[model samples]
Target: MSENLFVKWTILPQEPPQPLLYCKRCGGTRNFRSSGKIRVNANGKRVDAWLVYKCMSCDGTWNRPVLERQSVRSIDPLLLASLCANDAKLADRLAFDVEGLRRWAPHLKEASNAVVARELLSETPARPLELRILCVVPCHMALRLDRLLADELRIPRSRIHALEKSGALVVFPSASRALRKPVRDGTKLLIRPPAEDADWIARSAAYGDDCP
Candidate 1:
């Protein structure tokens, strides 16, 4: 059985959404609105609201304030996975280990937050082969199925299970037909893409996904 654990933390001072107003630079009545949660100091002394907005007509910048209060919630695996899916930066920061946790725990975060890593033994006559592939997509690049396949060697989610059912996509080592799982950190992925794809991959890979 595999075990998992997740570390929990809270972002305090919930922020409420605000309305847009006219821009002085553009003299335009229409304005864009943006919002973000409020952050408090560690000592719980200071509090502030923050938001970023840009004018549509003249490309002007606007900042707004939010005022609201919220309570803290427990951190769970599902929430962590959602964070990983939507915001890699926050996911990297919140994930941590729980000592003495079961190995097969479903909520476990990756060890050392190394989402991609493999361990192989050579002397064990017949050792399991674990291969990990990490695909880094640029934030600016649009997500597309074909682009994912050409780089990650994994079929799109829409075709993954179907291909596996028909025995078209086989897992390596055992030749079992299945979609290739995502690669975590520390795993070497075979990257083969055209010039344009290479450019995006190179740019996204420049930044380390792990928390600082």
Candidate 2:
């Protein structure tokens, strides 16, 4: 069995606060910030103070304290839309077994393009890891490579592919010659980690550039 089959893990921060504004033009909730000043009137007297902001969402203006401006944040409606949109897009892309592909094909294409762009920007460029493993027949049946790794092992596809490419994976075939071929439906394979590649794997998992 190859060590690559064993899952690698990592932690992420908790959820962030939602943005408050929505873009009127696109109906997106993500509003980019614009600078201005607050105007106030009290008891027939006019006062100009505080920093004003223009919503990326609707181009609306609002006032807030200048001194504490760093604490302010806004939710992006576009981001929320993308999240909901991506879910539907993923379902469509993986729906090869079912009908209605035509109806969702356009969305699937758009989503895929967006995802690739995001991944290119977001994913750290790293070499693959390797793992070794042994297993019984029939255990690998009826599963997509990504699905199986994510479900049974709780690892991600990107990591798995990286490990595979780097020769960190060693699959011990079952007694049957048929089991020796590339993993297919209903085959059981054991996954193990290559001791030598541990350091490389750790380095590959490091963080990359910040989002724009």
Best by TM-score: 1
The RMSD of every model to the true structure, in order and in angstroms, is: 15.6, 17.6
Clash count per candidate: 13, 38
* Residues 136-197 of candidate 1: C-alpha lDDT, one tens digit per residue: 32111122323333333323455434443554433333322213433211223323323333
What is the lDDT for 114 in model 1? 19
Scored by CA lDDT, what does every candidate get?
Answer: 0.30, 0.32
Assess candidate 1 and give its lDDT.
Answer: 0.30
**Model 2, 1-212: lDDT tens per residue?**
22232322221112111124444655655533324233322222222223344565566664433222221123244433332343434322222311232232222111110000111112232332432222222211222434334333334666665555564433333333332233443333333335554434333322212222
Model 2 regions lying over 4 Å from their true place: 1-132, 137-140, 172-212
Q: Model 1, residue 171: what's the lDDT? A: 34
What TM-score quantifies how close candidate 2 is to the native fold? 0.23
